[model samples]
Every structure is written in C-alpha cells, then in structure tokens.
Target chain A: MSRWKPDGRGRLEKAALELYNHKGFEATTVAEIAGRAGLTERTFYRHFADKRAVLFPSDNPLPAILADATASAPVPLPPLEVVTHALIEAAPVYEEREDLVRQRQAVIAANPELQERELAKLAALAATLTQALRERGLDTTTAALAAEIGIAAFKVAYERWINDPDEHTLAQHIRETLDTAKHLTTPAEHAAATDNVSFTGQQGTA
Target chain B: MSRWKPDGRGRLEKAALELYNHKGFEATTVAEIAGRAGLTERTFYRHFADKRAVLFPSDNPLPAILADATASAPVPLPPLEVVTHALIEAAPVYEEREDLVRQRQAVIAANPELQERELAKLAALAATLTQALRERGLDTTTAALAAEIGIAAFKVAYERWINDPDEHTLAQHIRETLDTAKHLTTPAEHAAATDNVSFTGQQGTA
Candidate 1:
C-alpha cells in the first residue's frame, strides 16, 4: 500500500468500467472502484473527482491542440479541411478504446443528466473550434458555420467508426465525412451571391 | 373566473412571462401561471405539460412544415437556398412574436437547466430538418450536414435580428445568413468529388 503505482489512473478507469458494466453506473461506488483497481480510496480521489468522471474522457488540452493545429495548417486549405486535420491529429487518444467508448456511450444514453453534459461538451468543442478559425482570419459568422460543419462531420464519422466491425481509424472516417459534407454543401447560388455582396478578397476577422 | 377564453395557451404564455420576469423562473409555478392567465389549473394542464413548456416554442408541426418546403423547392437550387426557402416559409409564425421570443430567450439564459433543455430542443429541430433533407433524395451524411448548417445559420441570423434594433424580418436575416454560409463553406478539394457520386441532374423527392 505504501509503494507507488505509475498506472493509477489507467487502472481506475479500467476498474470503473468493469464495475459499471456489471453493477450499473448509479449503483457503483468510489470505494468499490478503487478496490477493483487494487488501490485505496485516497488514490481514487487523487485521480478522479468522482465515480462518474472515471467513465468520462478528459478534453482538457484538446482545444489548445486543435487550435494550434488549425493555425499551423497550410494557408489555402478550406476551413473544413483545416479542422479535419486538427481533429485527425488529435484522434489518437480515442484510438483503441472502442469497447470502452461504446460502453460509456450506452451508460450516458441511459441517463438524461449525462446526455446533457455530453451535449454541453460538444457545444464547447464547437465554440473552441470556432474561435480557432476566427484566429485564422475568418469572419465571425463564417468561423462559426465552419466550426459547426466540422463538428457535424466529426460526429457522423465517430459513430460510423464505432459501428463498423472492421478496424478503422477515426481520422479516416473524419476525412471522408468532410469530403461528403463539402460536396453536399457546395453552393448553387453563386450568381445570387455575387449579386448580393461582392467579396473584398480579404475577409475580416472579428 | 368562469369566462370561456378561446386563447388559453396565448394568455397562459403571456401571464407566465410576466410572472417569470417579476419573480424569476425558479420561483414561478404552474398554479400561478394559470391564475394570471385567468384559467383553472386543470385548463393549464390541458394545454401544457409543465411551466417549462410555456417558454419553449411549440415545434410539433415545424419539422413537417420545413421538410415539405424543402421537398417542394425548385430543382437546381443549392442546399442552403433550399433551407432558406424552407425557413422563410416557416418564419411567419415567429414574425409577430419578437418581444415574446426575446423575453423567452432571456428567461432561458438565466437558468442552467433551461439552457440544457434549450440545447436539447435545438438538437431535435436539427434532427427533424435532417429527416426532411433525406426525403429530398440527399444521402444520409449530406442530409445531416446540410440541416445542421442550416440550423447554425438560423441561430446566427436570429441573434443578429434581435440585437440590431432595426426592423429586418427573420426571413430576410435567414436569406442573408445562407448566402454568408455559402461563401464560408465553399469546398477546396474538387477533384475527389468528381465522379464520386454524380448528382442525378434532376434530384427529386423520394
């Protein structure tokens, strides 16, 4: 008990998943999670805030990572592609966790509070991406639209990736989804657009 | 007290807003809402399931209306224009309620639980639009993306409309937002889309 364990967090996550699967999320306790992980309740507290947090993935540094990736992308890539690269670069953390992710999603789906938290998290991600695009010199509304489109693509891709029995990367699904979205949203009213407001070629970033 | 009022829902909504503004949402109750509306609690129950329902705009028929508009639009129009037409057709209901809409939004913002409910409501609206697009012969991913993008444009446009004290109608705002979205999401990689899945030249309702 006095010895240090480097895999404290990972063990707790795994233990929590097993217990959650068998005993259900609301019925499970923090002490039981720590016990399943062969650790003390003090160690659980050191890692997670509560039993629920163990099942939920951490998105702390992701916004910064996504923003940096988007800013560094090639000057001419469209907004969606820039976001695709950013999300793809950040997809490794979600790799190899298919079983856990599906299970966690089921647990969340069964609970309305968890579902709201999930939506809030998704909204936050979209807002972060929107700000990142704005920093790249796009206008506010354009940045917001592009960020939302990117998120829509990511969501479809994530669900598709998990549903397929064959092993596939989240990044590939995102790339393909973006292509489909691009083709789908392609403008047919270019004439109307030109008549409406001529672009200055240098769009402002607010 | 026994007067027969044909506009019970409208009166209840008006009364609820007055009370909510005076005493905050958490402090307000259904009995009070019914009392202010000059109706019985039983009457209020017949109209709305709860007090929160009064704040949320009834969207029961909106999905069908939007979908029907999209399906009936002229062929060769872009996805954004199709959505614009769909929303513009649906905008009449919102045209006369600017004050109520603004107040409802304010009331919703002040409470976290209401905010979550608002997000959920938005998601449902998006889903309904997605289904509508699907009926227009769009593939699943394309349909979902277009609907989400359309909703984003509507959200931005609605906010801009409320903020500007100017008297631009919601339909005009929606039209302008769609044009803006078109310029923003114009695709860069055109080669991959060529022959990937050629449009039917005359796309139609399914």
Candidate 2:
C-alpha cells in the first residue's frame, strides 16, 4: 500500500462512520478505521486524534465563520438579527456535508457521551457568538441572550432540515425556524407585523 | 458508630463537595466522602450511588415541580408565560440551600466531567418543560422554543443569583432575566410597550 494516499482524511472519516454505524462506536478501534480506509494507523492519527475526533474535528470552521459573520453584519441590526445573518452566512458550510452531518448526528444520538460533547460544542459556539457580539458593542446580557436564541433556532432548523423530505437548503430551514421563534415569542396582537422585521434581504418562505 | 445519622444525605453531600473541592473530583473517593461525613461506607452508598451523585441526585425535584407548575398555570397564558410561572414556582426549591448550591456550583465549575453532567441536567430539564408545554396543547415548535428560552433565562438568572453579592432571590433574578430576554428579542420599534404584556400577575422588578 502507498504510504501517502490523497484525501486520506476523507477516507478515514468515511470509514470511521461506516464502522461506527456497523459496529458500535465504543467497539470500533483506530486500527480498524485505518485498515478500512486502506491506510495505516499513523495516517489516522495524522488526520484525527481518535475515533471520536473523526466525528468532532478540532479544525471545525463553523465558529470562526459565525463570529466573522456576526462582526460583519450590517450595523444597528438587533443582536438576534445579527446572529441570524451569521447563521445564513454559515449555512453554506453545511450544504455539501449533509450526508456526513446526518451520519454524525445519528452516531451522536445513539451515544450519551457523544450527545454531551455535541451539546458542549453547541454551547461553545454560542459563547463564541456572544463574545463576538459583545466586541461589536452589545451588552453582555443582550449578547448572550441573542446567541442562545440563535443556537436554539439553528437547532430547530437543523432538526427540520435533516428530516425534511424535500431536501430544502439549510438556510431556508433557518429562516423558517427563526420566523417560528419570533412568532412564538411575540404576543398575539403584535403577530400581524412579523414579516416587517426581516432585514436580512435573503428571507424567503421555506 | 451509629448506623443511623440524622440528615445523612445532607452530610454526605456536604462532605463530598468539601472533598471534591479540596482534592479534585477525580482524586476523591467514596470511602473518603463517607469518612468525612462521619458515616459508614454502607451509609454513603445508601444515600448516594457514587461521589458524583452527591452533586446530581437522582431525586432532583426541579423537573417535576417545573412541569407541574407549567400544567397548572392559569389557562390561555402564552407558552413562555407558562414556563416563567413554572420557574417562579420552582424558585423556592433553591431558597433554603443557598450555601450548598453555591458550593456545588463551585465544585462543578472546577470539573469538566461534572460540568458536562450539569449541562445534561439543564438540557433534561428543558426537555421536561417542552413536554409539559406540549401537554398543555401548544404545538411542538412553539413548545420547544418556549422551553429553550425559559432554560436560557434560568441559566442567566442562576449565574447571577450564585454570584450576586447582594444575595438577591432566584425568583427575582428569574423575573429580571426574563424581562431582559423579552427586551432583547423585541423589535426596537415596539420596545416601549413591553410591560403591557405581563399577564402572569406574579411579575415583579428584580
């Protein structure tokens, strides 16, 4: 076998997920993942720290992409609007990885430990968004609240998108979920004007 | 040694927190906790499943109390209002254990494993609240969004209550935090009329 295989990381991830699905995450080993990928264990370590790391890569770019999007969003937008912009900006990152993301979510759903780590990852993303907003001059309370709401909307949208039969874009689901959240929170009398608040210019019915 | 110690569970919890704080949670052992509590190891096992259980008791009553309060809140209340009522109802549970709660927070703060468990606990509480709201006839999306928002407010209020030098009550913090969340999410054009929506009748300024 060749010492260097192109796209070694991709191969390892594909193999790891397949193995994890076929033979539980805990029972699978690094050696098996590498062997299945047609690579060596050394290549596996070069790509990921361990089996779990294959699912949750440390180089995940979603956090930085979101923080940058928040910072660059049009000024004077409410914090949630800023966060919504960030989600729309970051949605493209998930566009090409729907299958992988779905598989990872399935693996996480079956394991309690992975579920905790996934929650921590989402919480860390929210914290990053909060800090980014605070740096943009929002108060701590407002920043944190907006970040949490954004994550909640993202979660709802993700659930809907992953299970959606039509294969709609993640951005579309995000827009719909945010609308649902806004509608849920707004008192009934004020609900009539819900559409007037969309300043993102990218809004469309999901 | 007496086989029966009054308040043995409380003693075990107190001793476990002290030992965990001093020696770190990983380095601490069940026997040591039992010894520190002036109880036998059997008594320690009887009160808690393990050292970690001292912080996260299986019988934690907040979930049931919050769910009950959600179910019984005055009808026609919005989902968020119902959740807020549940939180207010559960606030009294923390009133008598201020010091223990604070200590537990510190211990959990010092340990990542414990922190994960703490996050799981909060997430589970959110799930419970969501189910309770769904049982109250709200749609799944609305119920989930309200529950997530309520938990976010609870987290903010909890951090403030634990760290506040003024010793403000958790109920007060919850009310204030909910107002802050409401204000943060409300559009700026409609911010002035926020107080008009308070139909809970239990509202108070923090």
Model 2 over residues A1-206: C-alpha lDDT tens digits? 56547788988999999888889899999999999989999989988988889988999999999989998998757667888889999998888888988888888889999888888888889899989987876656667777887887787788778888886899998887776666554456323433344431112311
Error of 1 at B46 (Å): 3.1
lDDT of 1 by residue, B37-109 (tens): 8899999888888888887756456677787898898867666567778888888767778888888877877
DockQ of 1: 0.21
- The alpha-carbon lDDT assigned to residue B112 of candidate 2 equals 78
* Per-chain TM-score, chain A, candidate 1: 0.83
TM-score of each: 0.80, 0.89
**All candidates: CA RMSD (Å):** 10.4, 6.0
In candidate 1, position B177 carries an lDDT of 70
Q: Candidate 2 chain A, which ten residues in sequence have the lowest lDDT sum?
A: A197-206
Q: After superposition, how far is residue A136 of candidate 1 from its true place, in Å?
A: 3.2
Fnat of candidate 2 is: 0.30
